[model samples]
Target chain A: MLFSLDPRISRLELPESAPAPPDKAALDQFPTYEVFHQRKENTAYVYVGPVHAPEADVAFLFGKEQFSRRFPCTGMWVVPTEAIRVTEYGDDQQSVYDRLPLLPADVLAATDAAVTEAYDIFHLKKRGKAHTHVGQVQATSPEAALQAAKAAFGDQRPVVNVWVIRSTDLLRSDEADRDMWTTTPDKKYREAIAYKVQDRIDRFKQEG
Target chain B: MYGSASTHDIPTQATTGLENEDPILLAEFEARIARGEKIEPTDWMPQLYRKQLTRMIEQHAHSEIIGSLPEGTWITRAPGFRRKMAQMAKVQDEVGHAQLLYSAAETLGKTREQMLSDLINGKSKYSNVFNYPTPTWADSNVISWLIDAGAIVNQMANAKGSYGPYCRALDRICAEEAFHLKYGHDAVVHMATGTPIQRKMMQEALNRWWPAIMTFFGPSDKMSTHTEILMRWKVKMATNDACRQQFLDMYVPKILEIGLTLPDANLRKNEDGVWEFSEPDWEDFKRVINGDGPCNAERIAVRRAAEENGAWVRRAMQQPKAQYVRPLA
Candidate 1:
């Protein structure tokens, strides 16, 4: 049996020796969801990172817990990785919109305002920086979304890349549930500032 | 809090295979890195860079998971409700760090499943200090304060590394680590200054852990083409010796201030401001890292059991159409 100082492990009665388990199947950890968070009210929803989850709801929960548990966050959004259309990365200090291929004349002409859906546009201001929500644009498709984003945000310099995701696909936190973001007063122990060891050390030194 | 400066079992003899890459693309890639631009997932990179980074980040991720085991065991038996809660929070953060790192590695083309498999099968390595048991609350405290202090030294350097995803993950991980370092310091100080028995236990634990902590950064790196290329790419960040020196420089005074003494007698700062200490047993470090450590079997068994037990839930929750895509930073 695997012995441990913690009786909890000893209780498990794990075998001392066992054959290595088989490798997990692909997607065993599930698909990825790109996460974005608002650090405070009236701030852009910036990309934090990605989380692996079974679905959008779980993704949102994981995103919130992973991205905002230690930091203050007022809002969160999680979208499936496959849903976000990404542009080629551009050089730092140069706008990626400059390299965007022109939308075909027929596609541009065929743009019907009534049929267009709302798409969220995100911009990478520089390489190694997180993408931030620039604005929303009405577009017929992901391709057109880039063009629409260009017309709206292309003038912004140092756009290293862009991500276009359908606004409907984003599983956003409900504004009514803002209480979830407020950390409890009892959890101060988890903050670095909560510990005061220097005082104790000083006392020991003084007494010695 | 466990991003080790050293990648255990680095294949120093392997050829870099740079000849196969297109000259123009290689030049551009090198130039981009030289210009201090971060390499994205879609960017063309040398085969060696991809392989080395995948291994390093994956190993760092495994360290976070395995490193938490020893500390997590202490949560149930922590001295008080506050300490227990803090311990629990720290363990949760470590596991969360593993999730973030796994996603970062996944962007390099490896699946999280494969990484976990490698960890259980002993194909990869975590920080070797965790392979030793934390026998007492004081032992666990040593880990919280000193082991984490060592890790912070390593991780702070790696946060400035070139990989976009790994750097991003480290930035977040480092932010959470501030609490861990302070909490650990607080825990150790509480024990060191508390009572006669408390001080003795803290001292004993420090004596037991000092060797493993010395080896935590791994052996001094031999300069070779392999190491040279990684440094130029900003992948290795700092040498193992440099990280160890920095750790000692920053933390040794703090440790001594609280009345705790490291077991090493030769450990001292020279007039040149360099630390000189007894050489850690690299042979023992190698042996333990290769699965002969005191707690290696137990750690792997526990991890493997958790994976097996949770398999059913994962299977149930998994969607047939779920497609994995590289994470966008």
Candidate 2:
């Protein structure tokens, strides 16, 4: 066993007898709704976490108390968790965008025509950081997506603005052309590999 | 802010067989660590590294949750509205830390359910300080200021560790804990400099908590295996004695400055710059950690009751046919 057990105490047990199990009907777990927060007018909306509430209004209330009570937050949005679509990137599988090609104009038009409704798409950009993909909500109209997007990703972090677009509006790159996206040879532009300007300035001063 | 050292019996040098691992892969991993690169969730790592990280992070997560219980009882009885609100938020942040830590540990393959089960079943240990009771509001204040000060010392070191998820979580948690430290200090100051009644209460609380605070970083590192390999891996950032000395150096002056007296009469720093204090009773620590303390039964009972009561909520949240999926960091 990885954990150590005390031999002196043969067994440690709960002191009180267990209470009777709860009835199923007594379990009133509310639906989980994802919350978004907008810190100010110009910033992006951010996903905070999920709140359990029966309706969007109550969720917003819960989100306010849970997240923004001590923190500065201007606006909040709450949407049912089930309404959000998540596309998680995996190491074993190539990212969906990397494998799929952009739809042709005619195919895109046909698909757009088939579904007049558009959904919002949110993508998480990286691990261990927030504000990548605040996530999206499916709605019948652009106005609804705009409204729903605010509630879902709003108050968890400092988000000033939110992105609202039709799901069909998303474009993908061809799998064979993946190198175009993957290749980056401009080491000078990246701070990690770029030589220190301050060091060079100090060296020149010493030479002078 | 929850990586307090455990009072349990220290394990022997556990990383002995890593010499037989693929030397090239080990070298690459070490090089990455040397370069200050974080080991991500999908990154290749030694089995022992994973096990140690998992155990450490799991214990930390447990500490956060169990740590909440002491101060959590004061939320309702907090003297006024401001104190009430601040107390609630501070306790909530502790629970939030637990949630973040559990998720971070989950990345190492142990499920949150298993960790919580271990916690309730006494198969795992939390920070030994939590097993002590908070008898009065002043005790909570002492914990908020001193215990959290010790945690910051431990966590700030571990925050620079090689694991990506735990480091990130610690970053956010430490930010919140900074606020808690301020909140706790404000309360303690008010009591220390307040009327005689308040001062006495604060002093009594301080005297009671000082011993446990001394033992918070675990026993003297000189007496243990010293976790040398864990240090090399950046998993255990500082030794127990180092953390303890740092805590005393930082907080001892502040404690005395606040007109509070610690229980130890001989606690002082020597000319050699090492903290010299009467050693805390290691036998008492062992006995308490083995489940004989004043509040151990109460703490575990409360946690067990919480788990039992919350089972319905967990069951309700579960989807009938949904498969378990590991969370992405």
Candidate 3:
């Protein structure tokens, strides 16, 4: 029998040896969602990381817990990984917009819609840096959005990469619920600065 | 909090199959690393680099997940309300760290499903120190303070590594680990300074954990072409001996200052400022790591049970027609 010092494990009465279960099937952990967060008011949303979930709502919840639980976040955003169109990464000193193949005016106009759809543009300032929200562009499609982003922020140099996602695809935290970010004073124990260990050690040495 | 500097699966031989790589592409990759450019997921990379990194990151992720079990067992019986709450938070942080690390490993082309499967099947190895059990509250405290301290030493070096996703994940993991170290130190200090019974318990726990802590960095590495290439590529950031010495330099004084004794009588700083201690039994370390440790069966059985029990919920939550895509950093 498998024995453990912890009573909970002991109670489980697990067998000493068991056959390895079958390998998990694909998509067992769900698809990926790219997560971003705003550290404070008026700050640009920065890419924190990614989460796996079934849909947008669960993704937002997981994103909040994963990214915001430890750090102070004023706002957060989660988008499906498939929804974001990424550009080829440029060198550290170069802007990725310069590498964009120009779409002819006729071709751009052909895909133009009466009501422009809003898309969010994020930029990587340098290699290895997280992408940050640059601005929004109105375009009929993701390709047009890239063209519009070039017009809006192409002058900003040193963009190593860019990610464009439809604004409608984002599940962002509501500005109205600002109180959720406020951690309780009692939670100070969780901070590194909470422990006054040196004082006690000093007392022990003095006694010795 | 439990990342070890040593990865068990790294090939120790001089043959790395470098000649098979296209000379031009290999030169560009090496030059980029030399220039301190971080390699993103989509970048062209040598197969050895990818395999080594995936193994390292996956093992680190598994450590976080399994490492939580011993500590999580303490949340119920922690000394008081405040300690209990802190314990719970620390355990939760470890599990969350696993999530972050699993996602980082995924960016390297391995699916999280396959990684978890390998973990339960015992094909992948985590930090070997976790194979031993935490038999007392004081034993748990040793893990919190010293094991976390050791992890920080290893992780701080890796945070500067070349893989962008792994580096980013390490950045976040290190920030949270600061709290764990302090919290552990606080707990250990409180017990050591308490009544005689408490002090004795604390001392006993330290004695029990010192051997495992010595082996925490694994054996002294024999330099090979594989090791040299990994270091140049920024895959293996520091030698295992370097990390172990650094941990001793930072922590030994702290343990002594608290009036506790390390089990090794010969453990002292030498003339050249090196720590000299009894060589941990490599035989025992190998036996434990290879599935003959005191608690190896229990750890795996528990992990397998968790996966088997949770399969139904995972299936229920999986969306129909869902497609798998590797995470983008």
Candidate 4:
């Protein structure tokens, strides 16, 4: 095994300032990808991995490095940065009024129907979570899609809002890639038995 | 990965598409998290989930980035070859860990560069522990021992967290922490039984770190934290006080056995099989987390310098390939 660093602290930045940018801003734009993990068919999709690639395919390598390094998983999904439909939030209206409750119930109901142009996406969460996308799907129209999500999901619990996106637009990793999931300790350094070298150091101390 | 926040306007939930009383949609989403399940990216979820997840993940992402300063300092000053090596590996793991976490956070819909900018500008915050300085070389051992110990305890429980990626990262981090704990303990034991100077170093380091270590878990969230909403939703797996207590129960004895006295005079084990210590100044915890700690400014400055310095590396990666530059074309 090799010598290990203390796991207590992190090192993305340095002491005086940051060490430097880890990758190119634009390079990241093209090469870095956002990872999505599906724990099970029943569970709502969540962001669970990271992959890097200059193109969509390259994302698989980095995504494997990021998501499957050591953690066990049922499935992994990696998509290019451009493939995502992201809307920025917290604008002037937030400061203008009504911070909490998100929206008036009536507004919630009306917008739900009004925005039904087609292909709406919904991100749902019971509690707020990191890697939250709530489950997203494309439908013919936003309202109908929202309706479908509600029928498929439910509206009793707090289902936030629906974001409409065309399914065809979303870039998803091949769900059938069994090979990526099976290649184990061979490729990942951390998974190697040698990674336990520090534990050996601990055992050495305990022996003394 | 930075966002175009300047042009982005916040839209109410209505605009995002919650048109009618979709009772069915709500149920499925609730059923998912309620069954000890993780919500995935393609499932039907409400918009608020994405918004809230974005906020929390961004802060956590920033934490991983800002968290580096205190310990990275000691990488150069670690005692012997073993310590130095251990320190190096640990820091690298942290970088990897941050990458995992930021990637997870981005799923909530913000880019990594955007999160970094927030950290540099002081708009985002990390764990209060990072806001303080590691004043001595021994401080590195203490950080690995205590701070990491506290984090492990929190993350262990968090491995069961509702969100998939955060939980996965926690699982991976927890796996690595076993070695980390041993490294810190090894340091403590090595120092305690080593030279007289080494023992003194350990004590001083503990004295400075003990309170902050206790504060590692945010102050008792009894009065706030919306734990009910969060827990039912799966944002956190346990309560702050409970996790803090668990950390004390597990580590206090270990620290003492390592031949180090905790800084508290009143620190003692209780009749109920719990180790009890004086409450850390909750106010101080707030102050530290709020960016008023001893080393908060210094930590931020270091992060900014590193980010700025590293800009070209990022630029180089993005520069058009020289292979494509034809002669006089």
| Candidate maximizing DockQ | 1
DockQ-superior candidate, 3 or 4: 3
- The segments of candidate 2 whose C-alpha lies over 4 angstroms from its true place after superposition are A1-40, A44-70, A73-208, B6-10, B222-226
Residue lDDT tens for model 2, A1-75? 111122112133444434433333321334555666655544666656555554556666677665555455655
**lDDT per residue, candidate 3, A38-95, as tens digits?**
9888989999999999988999989988998888888999999998999997767889
- Identify the CAPRI category of the predicted complex in candidate 2: incorrect
lDDT per model, in order?
0.90, 0.67, 0.91, 0.58
When candidate 3 is compared with the true two-chain complex, its DockQ is 0.82
Q: DockQ for model 1?
A: 0.84
DockQ of 4: 0.06
Q: Which digits, one per residue and each the tens of the lDDT, describe model 1 over residues A14-49?
A: 999898888888888888999999998999999999
| Candidate that scores best on TM-score | 1
DockQ of each: 0.84, 0.05, 0.82, 0.06
- Candidate 4, B69-184: lDDT as tens digits: 66777877776776677777666666667776666676655666567767777776677777667777788778766777777776677667666656666666667667666666
User: Residue B30 lDDT in model 4?
Assistant: 72
Question: Could you tell me how far off, in angstroms, the CA of residue B88 lies in candidate 3 after the best superposition?
Answer: 0.7
What lDDT would candidate 2 get against the real structure?
0.67
Deviation in angstroms for A147 in model 3?
Answer: 1.2
Task: Give iRMSD, candidate 4.
Answer: 12.1
Ranking by DockQ: 1, 3, 4, 2
